[model samples]
Target: MNENVSFYRDTWAEINLDAIEYNVKSMVEHLGGEGTVIAVVKANAYGHGDYEVACAALEAGADMLAVAFVDEAISLREKGMKVPILVLGASRPEDVQVSIDYDITLTAISLEWVKKAEQFAKEGVLQFHIKLDTGMGRLGITEKEELDELIQFAADSSSLSVRGIFTHFAAADELESDYTDCQFAAFKKLLGGISNKEWLIHCANSAAGLRFKDRIFNTVRLGIAMYGLSPSKEMNKELPYSLQEALSLHTKIVHVKKLPKGGKVSYGATYTAQEDEWIGTLPVGYADGWLRQLKESEVIAGGKRVQIIGRICMDQCMIRLPEKMPEGTKVTLIGRQAEEYIPIDEIADRLETINYEIPCILSARVPRMFLRNKSIMEVRNPIIQSHSASKG
Candidate 1:
């Protein structure tokens, strides 16, 4: 247990703020002022570091910031971000005043929770939005009678302010248009428009944002796409604007060993040397979000592509380097190097998941070095990467 030996090696994720602005510009250009994009910075801005991504997004003209919880909003607030933050998900009733103290808006569908919030709010003022369950069947007011009263109360309340009305699309990105249209129609019927209070009404997520321009809600919740990634494969195909992958995972080779053709590598001897080859160990692994499912995957090393040999370990993974490169060489798990690039989507596709999880999973233990214009712009505080995170 050496004091300075970092358990993580072999891979790390890179994020570029410059590309973030580009992605925001792409979406705004495609929108052409049809609607406002409320950038979703929840889940630590989808694992790209919430404050940094949120700052970058605001730099690119994102109108508002949305999060899934109160603490996240509080974090952005702590960073001195003066932009409006709307908690798009759960906010415990006990913490309503804390939310108010931070000037954050909480989402409420239950009259009970609203009443609780009203109790805690100072000056009887609690700015919050009501989430409607159009079809997602998630957290939101679903019953008609409840929704009507909630709307009326919001309109009449002196203590509560209805900042906006919104809903989620269950299938906005699918080619099958039936479900999306249904959700939209349901949301429209529920919110014909509130009188007296001119709140911004928005309901389009990334998928709905790109398609159904005529059906544009008052505001769009731009999540995955805002970070230069898409919600689904089909949407990527139909994207009206070119998207750049804002987050890149990179690391350097710290240790290289030349193994004979018969050498066994990693757990289970899953990978045997294919002739005499160079095996290099990176300083990070599945613990850092380099999923073990990518056991047979490849990472860009020394300007050339190399394969991850054997089962990915918990704190580190091994890649086979070429004779031209050795210890101390840089390996690219997500970004570009010379003529080769490993987009995050490729890894997601390889693992049968969405690209959103890649950066999020790169535990906080691995440091995120932010880049702007291809140079180190800033290094975020150390990621809380959990090594005990079930081994890769």
Candidate 2:
């Protein structure tokens, strides 16, 4: 299945494309004909593999794809993604031509950005979605006067085409946020000036989409929830339906050794065997996104959970095996093995971070093996590709 590049490492992330499709379909069903779903495949689909996840989302009836910036949109375009790709972040006014050339939609956060972009819009239609800063305080028009000027300018420009207007909630993850209520009220007041009611209006991210159906106007941006992750731990209880997690981290035990009683393991000699114990070396470490902070974490081996012992090295770590497991035995850093399972949330807990940050932090050196219909669909090995490109 992995014929293109011979993988030289034992550790890789397995991405289930079916799970991605399932999550999208679940969201579509949850919306129940309420609005269009905008699949947020930014940060390489939260590091699940962008192109692969985008294709899966589209296949599951996502109306459009959203990315954080223009380069991300361009990457999807380069991969032949034909569906509408919206750049949710601010872009340089000079980059207007590139968006037009690639058929990517740009976000107009302010009149200043719009006027600067107008200079670059010598020719070709440039589509835009006006962003309103209701409560996020990140970008967009905060006042009615700014909104009116931006709308009027776009309506007057020969090259500019304003397709939509939207805002973001600062605390949609919290079900009881008075701030979210005020933000929606502000967004509605701003919407009063715009005559075009058909413009794609959206104000809901994953959390809002799942909890507040009234706020999701015509479109919902599915980001964290699209990857089968809850928008926040607190919102997990309110999920209308269950989501299928798609990624699993795996590696193989490369070396096994018997540690004498009181013998130490790894660089700092932090882990000592109270009794004679079997230790297995895994070819995964901090350099591969397996941070040293996870040295105390447990991994699934031989159908049981085993502790990762010692200070995690740059390229390797040691685990205390229950017995003398043979070299090349399977080890699951994340996912199910027999009855034992290690969710990404557990890894996140150990690192004192969110589950969304886990996969995004996985280094490029780790290959992503995409699975579809329970078979290997494709393998993306950046290391091998770089090597091949250098030789060429």
Candidate 3:
């Protein structure tokens, strides 16, 4: 073990901050100064590490940051992120004072929730954004009357300040524009009722901002795209700018052996060697987000794609090696090796999921190594940190 290394595991996730910065800059360029970009760093920046990605986005010219809830915003605040952060999800009435103390903006989903929040408000004004339910059946004010009432109520309350009004697009990633057009129309109709037009008006997420530049108001929430991923598989071809993926999963082969032709591998003996083949065991499994569903998935080994074989165990998995690879040979699970590459979308396809979930599902057991300009900047190992805290 290296003297400076704290984590014992060989499996790790690598995040390229340069790629994130590049992606953010590309989105800003795509906007052409017409609107501001609110870097969505919720869900730990979609599992890319919120603080690291948030700083990269801000450095790349993102104007604001947005998270899913109050706790996420507070976590950023505790990290000393002073950027304007909007909680896109509804916040609790009791947490209103906490948000105000931290200068965190929240979403006002309904008049009732706002009234409750106002009752809890103390000492400082609580700023919020009004959410309109254009078409999505999720949280927001659905009717025009309710929206006007909420708007007027905010205007009347001295403790509350409405900073923005926005809605979400349900199918903006699809090639068809009918649903998006309908939502935009509804948003416009709702906008007619509000007297304060200066509130930061925004309704476009990554998909809508990338596909429909004409429909954006003055801000766009940059989420998955800012991490260099398409909003959906269907929108891959429609992306205005080519995105550079920022995260890669990798591990070192800890053990290698040659299996006889009849030799079986892993838990269920589901895999039998067709020929005398070299097999490698990786120190990664379901606990590390390497699910059993990816039994036949391919990973880069020896500069070529090789299939994973047999039942995946809780702590390890086996892969068929093309040649005799020594222990500690680098294996690329979700990145490029030589001329071959395994994109996140490919993993998502194997699991029948979205690209966003791929990184988010990566468990904290795997240390994240952050990189900038191809050099490692920091290594965040949650396991080691927790262990140290327990020891202390």
Candidate 4:
């Protein structure tokens, strides 16, 4: 651990780079000469740190990287990553030149956007992928004629190169395959007779890649599954291989007190002790991405499950301790402590959201400590870094 990286607040997210590497390798092996894996590192690799995750994925045999926008691609480029990066979202006309300069691939959603981008590219070829809106009503060209026009326009443009074509899956995680089949069929129809071997034609995301193995696309965009999370609860059991979770949240008790019978806890006094009990205050709350709705959730302390009591506050929450635990005792929020573990799925279920949202929702205020080979490799404390830089 870095000397500057102190556990001062005792709340931080631990990122296991080894698990990430393993997951990517497993996915790549599963592809087994069928296709390549485009590791999706968007939204900071689902809030597990993009640069770190990208490096791990690439080291583990990922063929390419995908982000939500051009800025993300530029960020990785600035960090000296030279892998093929594709922006999966629409880019501003003004920012088209940046993509060209960085050799980053942008997604061409419309002919109007493509024509506008041509105006911005002063020199060199602007590489991009044509996004086909097969079923995902999001960004992409839906009509076949529009797609044809875009392809012709790109071919005519001296500064544009159509490097790939792809589409999004609307519900590939679901049990029913009718909609996915229709989407894949439409994608195939859209690319009908365009047999340019160099053009990358892909449609499978993490869900589609695992579930629909019969339909092999040239590339699979590994997203949620790359982070050791299932696409959905229903699809968990059907995974071809087991996934290892890469992120774990932890904090320590900052304060401890013995409350008498009928004593209230937290704001609104929603929880009251029926008998004399020990209470421990954690330094994590909704502000740290531990949402207030998790008040009913349990955390591990001293190898025991402790119930979070009362309303969760902005910077603190009270947990009913089984015994008088001293301040600074470790608490496991979303990982294994001793023999018990609190999974992200459980937290997502309580929040009525998907597992993807759980980690992404974690606030930047909480520091992230990266681990490799069961050892701490780097600790990123934004708050501490900002404070130290201000002094320097």
Candidate 5:
């Protein structure tokens, strides 16, 4: 089903557009008529083909799209996406005009940034959201006096339009909701008399949006959950709705060899065969975002779990096979195989990280093959595209 089947390498990531659409629709319906969903497509939709995911999200009722920087928003624009995009990070003063030119929304982190951006505003109105650092203490206005000043300045500037004001929840995904409650209280106190109707006021990421639905907010930035990942493992039990995982990492065994007892495999000579064993070399490694730390992890082969032995290399890794599997055997790093499964959460648990980091770290070296209805809809191979373009 892959149109570029002959071009890309054996290792690739399969993205399910249907699953993405389902997740988005579930989030919207779960909101229960309170707020709109802003599909957070930053980090290339958390490294799952941004444009494709964005299109699927919009089709599923997402009200807007949000990215981390200006260039990311521009990329969506270049792909003919006209949805309102809010850049979540601070925009450089000099590049404010570029955001304005693209009709993108910028985040006003501080009164100083607002003042600086006002000076750069040349012609049309620039829309932005005021970020409040209620408790996160990462970005946004932290002081009440500063918030007042910024509100006044934005009101006075004819070239600037304040479309929304938002804060981030620090512990919304934890079992304890006390901290989230305090953060919401602080956000309300900071708002004072600023009517929510006047501007879009949001404070919920995926976790808070689901756990604290009673909180009054007009917009919810759907990030991890939109891609069918729980914000935290502990909170999985409390989820109100089911989420379908949309990503799967797969590769074919390119080489297979039988090693006798006392044989060592890969770098460091770390893995020594206890007895005669069949070893398969996978065409995926740290370079492809399969971190070396996953050397002890497991992959599915022959519909069974196989131990990954030896240190993962820059471009390859080895998996101990159940038997002498034939070459081109399908290996699943993060997906289902017959009766066995390797979830992203399992990989995250092994790596001592969160589920969000798992997919986001998958390098572009592994091309993305998007599927719908169990058939390849499109293939994005940067290596092949670059080579073809150069030749042209």
Candidate 6:
């Protein structure tokens, strides 16, 4: 069976659409089939390939797609994603109109930004969410006077329409309402005075959509939980439904060699052979989202788990495969079968980080394959706009 594997091949990131569709449908149960939901596909769908995952989410009934910037929106538009896309993050002041020109809605917080958008408008109205900050202390306006001023400005400006008013929860996924309730109360207080405008008053993200009963919102922008990842560790025990992971990563052994006892391996000689044993080099490493900190973890190979040894290099990592395993053995960096699974959660746990970083860190050099109905559908080439690679 090892003959089928090519040692020279590059590692791959695999996406399962069936599971993605299942996750979206399960998450959208509360949004109802009619209510709008904006799926955040900014980081190439968290490195799952935006176009591929966007289709799955839309197929599962997502009302719109959301991203962080104009460049990302253009990528989706270039790739034929015709669904309405809203830039949830702030649009560059210089490119505000560029976003409007491409039919991409922006999240404008000030009258100046709204006016900047007027330069590109010739006909149909340009839309954007008025972001309000309650607790996350991020890019949002918390001052009621300023928010009211913006609202008043929008009322007079026919070119701009207040599509939505939203705020981020400080601790919704923590399952604690102390701060969440405060944020909600503040959002409600702000919304109470605003009248007849048909703006989508939304604050609930994935956690609120799943746990909270009174969502009190027209639309929910789901990000992490849509990919079947719990927003935080606290929600793990409280989740009433099982969530299926949508991403799976796999690679094959590139080299298998037996070393003498006390032989040191890899760069820096950190891992010394305790006994005469077999070692297999995997072609997946930090470059493939397998961070160097995960050197303490293990990789599944030959139906058994193998510990990663020594320092992880840019394009390769070494795992202590069984002495009996033949060369070219299939290595599973992340999978879901055979009494084992290396889903993103596991990697996150090993690294003591969030699930978002796992997929986001996978280098663009790794080709992502999209699978639908348990069959190979298509391959999305390396992302060209990898400018956000260093972030998070």
Question: What residue runs in model 2 are displaced by over 4 Å at the alpha carbon?
Answer: 1-5
What digit string (tens of lDDT, one per residue) describes model 6 on residues 121-197? 65667788888888888878878888888888877877777788888887888765578888898888877777755
Model 1 scores what on Cα lDDT?
0.80
Model 5 scores a TM of 0.97
The collision pairs in model 5 are none
For each candidate in turn, the TM-score is 0.92, 0.97, 0.97, 0.97, 0.97, 0.92
Given candidate 5, what's the lDDT at residue 251? 93
| Clashing pairs in model 3, backbone N/Cα/C closer than 3 A | none
The pairs that clash in candidate 4 are none
Worst 10 residues of 2 by lDDT: 1-10
True-structure Cα RMSD, model 3:
1.3
Q: How far is each candidate from the true structure, as Cα RMSD in Å?
A: 4.5, 1.3, 1.3, 1.5, 1.4, 4.1
Please provide, for model 4 over 1-392, each residue's C-alpha lDDT reduced to its tens digit, 9 standing for 90 to 100. 24667657789999999999999888888888788889999998999999999999999999999999888999899989999999998899889888899999999999999999999999788999999999889889888899889999999889999999999989999985689889988988988868788988889899988888766568899999999999988898899999999999999999999999999999998898999999999989899899999987899999999999999999999999988998889899998989999989989999999999999999889888999998888887778778998999
Ranking by lDDT: 3, 2, 5, 4, 1, 6
Model 2 root-mean-square deviation: 1.3
Residue 42 of model 6: what lDDT?
90
lDDT of 5 at 169: 91
Q: What digit string (tens of lDDT, one per residue) describes model 3 on residues 33-108? A: 9899999999999998999999999999999999999999998999899999999997889999999999999999
Q: What residue pairs clash in candidate 2, if any at all?
A: none
Give the Cα lDDT of each candidate: 0.80, 0.91, 0.92, 0.90, 0.91, 0.79
Task: Please say which candidate is ahead in TM-score: 4 or 6.
Answer: 4
